[model samples]
Target: MSAPLIVGSVAYTPNVVTIWEGIRDYFAGSPAEMDFVLFSNYGRQVDALLQGTIDLAWNTNLAWVRTVAQTKGACRALAMRDTDTVFRTMFVARAGSGLGGLEDLTGRRLALGSRDSAQAAILPVHFLTRAGLTPGEVDFLRIDSDVGKHGDTGRSELDALRAVLDDRADAAAIGINTWEAIGRDELMPGALELFWESPVYSHCNFTALPALSEERATPWVEHLLGMDWDNPAHRPILEMEGLRRWVVPRLEGYASLFEAVREQQIGSRW
Candidate 1:
């Protein structure tokens, strides 16, 4: 018998335990048995991955970029959720704020989430700059809540939205996930509208080091890709993890983020 594959993930929410436990149970009968450990933040998880403390890490876009940089492009992205692709940043404002687009944000107060959040902070700045509104031109009210979680908790995004509602900011940058969640939950019903949305980018993935050989990596990935979205046993985990299917890692969708991180000069260590 071989040792179980150890995977690392951030404890972004309480449900993380349940989610991973379900995944471990699903793999118990498979040739590739698996186990997981949770970290407080992505930084620690990324560090663990790079140090070979774990076989794999569930990484956000920012973490993935940092891992690639730290490894000199030696790391591999194994798989990602279907929802991880086509991620966008939304510029939101109170209805009738007269904010039509990014151009309208010039000289206005803009709220941003955590400094490390790719969609809410980094990419928003990149898009704004491309839109001809430099950071110096806008009054930024940044909320750093859950900075290391990489906006997985959505706490900072909610704060950014609150800033808009309270008139503390004329606009806010948030992830598409938070935007759709607000609609689904009827949060502040009809009080806000999208002013603009950014181009699509990648979000999260299962990243692994090159040292994790195909003998183990191959079976692990095969079992992960084999998860049936239609299976009753797998549906609960899929729903909780916010994906209908696990798809092959889409590396191209991360180009924008890779460029954004470089343009922003976000630290590669963290």
Candidate 2:
């Protein structure tokens, strides 16, 4: 019998356990049996993937960028969630803060989530810089909550939002997911409003080294793509993971981040 395919993921929330368990159960009857290991952070998971301790990793954009850089573009992205393809960073402020746009952020206190978070921190700064608002142009109030987890926890984004609400900062940079979540859950209803939205970028994906053969990888990818979102058996896992369908990775969507990391001089080596 073939060994089970080992996958690594960060334990960002309790639901991670449920998600992976369901995936394992789903693959039990498939040709490619699967198992998972959870890490406290993405850095460690990325390391395991590079070190060949795990065959695949559920990597965030930052992790994926690092892997590509560290491997000199030799790594492969197998698939990503449908929701992961259209992610955007949002700049929000108190409903009546009078912030018109990115230009208005100049000389004002702007809060950001964990430094490593592509959506909440990295891309926000990147977008602001692209809009002519350099780091020195804004008074930054950075919240580094759940840093190593690469903003997967969303704790820092929430803190940044609270900072804006409490008058601690004039605005906050957060992921579109958090923005929608706040509306869906009615968390602090109407206290915040979107000041700006970033261009769309990709988020998370299944990354693997070149050494993982197509023989093993193809079956796994096929099984993931075969998941039926409408089926009751798969719906719960799909909802928990925040995607209705698995799609092939869009390499172009990652160009901004690749340039941002170089421009910002963020360390690629985990």
* Candidate with best lDDT: 2
lDDT of 2 by residue, 56-145 (tens): 999999999999999999999999999999999889998888998999999899999999999988888888889998669998888998
TM-score of 2: 0.97
* Candidate 1 lDDT tens digits, 1-270: 789999999999999999999999999989999999999999999999988899999999999999999999999999999999888899989888888988888789999999999989999998988888766898889999988999999999999999988999998999999998888325666689887988888899999999999899888889998889889999999999999988899899999888888888888987
Q: In candidate 2, how many clashes are counted?
A: 0
> Judged by lDDT against the true structure, how good is candidate 1?
0.91
Q: TM-scores of the models, in the given order?
A: 0.97, 0.97
At residue 243, candidate 2 shows an lDDT of 95
Task: Name every residue pair that clashes in candidate 1.
Answer: none
Model 2 per-residue lDDT at 130: 93
lDDT of 1 at 233: 99
- How many clashing pairs per prediction, in order? 0, 0
